[model samples]
Target: MSRRSLARFVALAAILSMFGTSAAVMPAQAADQVIKIGIDLPVSGADASDGIPTQNGAALAVDEANAHAPKGIKFAVDALDDAVGGVHNPQQGATNIRSLAADPAVMGVVGPFNSNVAAAEIPVSNESGLPLISPSNTNPTLTKTAKYRTAHPNEITYFRVCATDDVQGKAGAEFAKTLGLKKVYIIDDNETYGLGLANVFEKDFKEMGGAVLGHDHITANQQDFKALLTKVAATKPDAVYYGGTTSTGGGLVRQQMGAAGMDPAKVKYEGGDGISDAEFIKVAGDAANNSYYTVAAPNAAKSASAQAFINAYKAKYHSDIGAYSANGYVAAQVIIAAAEKAIKANGGKAPTRAQVLKNIQNTSGFKSIIGTFGFDKNGDTTSPVIALWTIKNGAQDFVHQINVSTK
Candidate 1:
């Protein structure tokens, strides 16, 4: 061959090699396009204790999903703080939900930790056909209401990964009764969650031959609980049940009682999941010791899968995962798994909100970092477990995992 002809052949070979290399890189690059999941939780302000951990858990799940890259589909989390301005603000919750729902890239949402927020966001979410799985919203009214069922039949996009307050309150009451606590002073924050749980505890405790010494109401933002504490102290009850978030509950536990002139060890202060956060330690200080609270058992980090998740979370974020972090992570897992299932069923197309909702409802016996998770017809987890914890040395230490008798 002539010199010019040989050079032309070499150039053609070089062009083909470049094309081959480009084709090889395209698939990996295509896999990098992530499916975004919306995370609406309280990352700051009053509810940050629960909301931040919930967000962290969701982030952990997103990281795992991306690392595993199931079916070449990457997962991305878009976190929004519902309690950015303050806690228990329905308007802020609605705003956050609307903002997330407006994003076409967001296939589903992982939170809105407060039941009141869930109540507010349900209508907006239903209108947008957005599937929202809450890790902590346990109010029965969210799913059981006739209005909610009528408006969102077959398309019920709201689901919870934890047991409702009915179960939580009953379990808590039973636990206290077992401890031989006869007279209990009950207090609530007046919000949907606080009031609802308080009612449940009151009814159950009464039924179990326990006496209600007194009942009081407290606002969410009130820092001065001395008046209520004084009343409770006067009652001389065996235990004080606080139905509110850690922000108020912890402060009341620390400042109102204990070294602040009240005998902390003499009276047991019990609360629901709201007071189960580590912030309770900071707020309650030494009073946190021996303080008992109830929370979703599935959120514990003791299981093998949970420990794995915690390790991965720590490795990625270099921080301690909070109380509800594992539950939120599992919530994200449910959403992502459903999305993947829907996508596969739709012949590699991204899932529709409706399809994803169905997938979430039908999802059963799936292994998660929080153990087995599956929802029943009422949008409640089938294996709902409640755990009691006590504050020890300014930290929440697992005490007993309450086996839920109710479905």
Candidate 2:
């Protein structure tokens, strides 16, 4: 064995060792490609019962995706609260979306539950070319009207999985009539969502030959509603339809109706999805009886496809799913499908926000936990459904669902 031969062998061995190390290190580095899904919702204060459950649904999807993610891909959730004090704030939502958009790793977003917050965040997200898939923004103006688009009216970056107010309001009015509610009074919170729903319900009720005794708007944070209830009582209305959320005076109005000479159980109390939450029942207490409401999405808990999701949700959060929880999961699923496509198109690398947005816009035949649906040109769900609910024995009971009619 000559020294020269031994030196040559040593050099070759070192080269092979270094090559082996590089091969092992490359996969670990590639596995670090983290794609984040930003969740902007009112996850604090009174809204937590709704927002936290919705956020939990998205988070649960992320967890499940990571379990089966491709070798070099991983998913994460970046959650931000848009709640200020006790309710959702538009400015906070805009700020949260801007923060999420500036992050290059965030491929898409899944929230801003309230329609009003969505209105404020849409322009910002659209300007940034960031995709936002909402679980619950149901106001018609967010997608039907062009004013909220900022300067990019033609380019849609916001999509929602829920039915719009036009359908929900009409459904509420129809249901009221079904209960023989002939004369009714209407009240709204004066916010974008509440006022819009109230107006639609009013028109539909009138067209259905039901008398609208009077209509009113409640001021923000107005605690004492006895005066308004007294005025409403004077109309001798057979029912009172509130077009606002529990946080925005839905439960309070129903609770105070007795002081205004109307028995909460005898006189029908109706509202939109805003009041179809556990918080509403908590707020209205025993007065919650005889209360009817509607949800913009189908009854996910009843869907066979959603059973696994519901069980997973309960197992993870140790609580029942909220009204929009499955909708949130569906929104995340849409983004996940689009992100997977974008990554493959980019050769297994993280894709650009624009690429992901374009893929989401092209989402078709998406089978979600809720149902089989796709996004229309306006970013609205191709199949829209509304669920009716009632408070019975101090719990939410699902009545039935309506397939929204465009006409």
Candidate 3:
């Protein structure tokens, strides 16, 4: 052979060694089409315990989807923090949604954990035709009332995986009765979610023949709840129900109960999903004992379909699932399912926001690790279920779960 022929043979041998014999016959793989899922939550401060796990759940879904996504598509998470000064801020949530909406690559968003934040972001997402599926927002007016729909009444872009406060509050009231607590005092954080949940709990508790000694509201981040606890102690109530989250005085109220001579051990404390966080326990300290809370979503740990998800979640995050973590996963599943449908209809191209939105709205009978359910016309979960939990030994312990009738 000539020198040129010998060099060519050596180069061919190197190529064969690099890729093996099948490389010559196999076609080149196409680059994956990237689709982004935006996550908006309070990822810092007191709420980080809940926010981080919720984001992890969604991120886990993205990881799984990317691993098994169609031959030419991939998923990514664009998580953005909507917390200002360590708490969830509505204005910040609105800004985050606007930013996500501006990104053509972001097909959907999962966030605004607090209901109040959801209220501010709904209008922006509606106008942008971007879907906001929440893992924890549970205020009824978000979907039941017309106030949030003023921007675009014809189009509903907000959805959630959890039951609304109306159902959760009623369930809590019923649970209180079951616990043989006849007299109760209610306190709220004077915010949209807290106040609304308190109102429902108060009304239902009264209707069930339970005495509501008194109801009070506290300012946000007030830091001092001694006066409120003093008044609550004077009532001699069997239980003190708080309608708020840890960041908004849920933990402080329980902790101050002891300072006001209302031993948390003797006086049972209860609250909604707002207070159902690890931060609440940490802040409440020894007073965390005897504190019972309700979650607006079904018990994922109890769901037979959820075992696999629980295993997968633990494997990825190396921690137990948070209250709304499964809800976050389900929310992401809804978005991914919708994206798949939209992409298929669009001939395998990146789907438009409107296309994704329409597909999301059409989601029905979708089965997830949590359960089989779908979005109703109002974009609320058809599975309106709530779970009860308590703090035992400074950690969360599942009590029981019940399904609430939305009708």
Candidate 4:
């Protein structure tokens, strides 16, 4: 060959060799790498009963996401215990966030399951520009704050799969009104979640012209609420509103009310999403019967996508799906979808945390197992559908799905 032809051939060979080297390195990079997702839930304390399942649901989602991930990326979940002693402490939640944030590998976070915990940890994630999607946190104050807007101006980094307490409390009040409840006693656990939700319910119930017989507060770890129940029973209220989780508040519903000589059927009990679980039914037992709860709309298990998820979850874990599991799964789905979009937008390169946050905030009308989900400007789920369920014969049966809007 002539000198020019040989030079061209040598250049082509050098380019081909570089391409071969890069191709060989790509699979090793994919295999050795992982996209980290942080999970903060009370996995080892009093709240573990609720938290463990949520963690499991999140893990299941991660597994499924990895199994179906596009050729170049794999997902890994870093499940951290936010449970401190017997409580889901905000300090612990914040610590978890700091730890996750310090690691540059984590693209997003899945929780701090309790709204109380979210109150502490979300700001940290916000400062770090890490998108934190909560599966269960419902406090309205989270997304309504000026700080949230100031910190996350481009897109709301904080998103939730569930409806907020503003919607949940209103749904509870409406349900009580529908039942013709005239007078009700409100009790809260004094935590961020309990107090916030209780206040909302109390306001709405009273504004509806219903009577608020009395309101009380209790510590979350307290086991005895007989004195409070006695005072509430003396008020002759038609119903009682509990604003806390099953771990701290469920037994009070049955034991304290029974000790006060109040017949379970005679007094209606209502609570927010915290008490809407199978564990609450177990803890409250017979008292749980006829009790009502407000929760995010029930997973339409009949939907083909939902059923497929249920089946995959059951087959993988050999456990039945619970009230919060599907929500947790959907929360993971949202994060993964956002990450995938970000990666694609980055031309097959892994996205940085800022890019992921932007992608998540810009996520509009993404199809999820729960339904079509999009966040409002405030980071709240735009789909404000709450479901009222009644415990009948030891099972929570769906009563009605209420479509609510602040407008």
Which 10 consecutive positions of candidate 4 have the poorest summed lDDT?
146-155
Q: In model 1, where do residues sit more than 4 Å from their true spots?
A: 1-33, 70-72, 86-88, 147-150, 258-261, 405-407
Better structure of 1 and 4 per lDDT: 4
Task: Report the number of the highest-lDDT candidate.
Answer: 2
Better of 1 and 2 by lDDT: 2
> How much lDDT does candidate 2 score?
0.90
lDDT of 4 by residue, 1-407 (tens): 99999999999999999899778767543353578888888877557767877778888889988877866788999889987886688899889989999998899888878887887877787778877888888888888774543454554678887888888888889889998899999988888888889999999999999999988888757887777788888989888888888776764565468679678888888888778767787778788886888886555563577887788878987877766677788778778887788888878777788888777777788787777778887777777668788888988787777656533
lDDT of each: 0.79, 0.90, 0.90, 0.80
- Give Cα distance to truth, residue 348, candidate 4, Å: 2.3
Clashes of 3: 1
User: What is the per-residue lDDT of model 3 for residues 1-407, given as tens digits with 9 covering 90 to 100?
Assistant: 99999999999999879888787879888788889999999989998988999999999898988877765889999999999999999999999999999989899999879999999999998888889999999899998876887678978799998999888899899889988899999999989999999999999999999999999988877899888788888989999999988998899888889889888888999999998888998999999999888998887888888998899999988999999899898899889989988888878887887888998998888988877788888999887788999888888899988876543
Model 4's alpha-carbon lDDT is 0.80
lDDT of 1 by residue, 1-407 (tens): 99999999999999999899888878554544468899988878767867876788898788777766656577788888777455656778889889988887788899888888888888888888888888888778887764554455656778888878888899889889877799999988888888899999999999999999988888757777776777677778888888878755545555577543457777888888888776777777777776788886554666776777788778877888877788788889898888888878877777777788788889899887666768877677778888877777777788777557453
With a 3 Å backbone cut-off (N, CA, C), the pairs that clash in candidate 2 are none
Model 2 lDDT, residue 219, Cα: 97
- Of 2 and 4, the candidate ranking higher by lDDT: 2
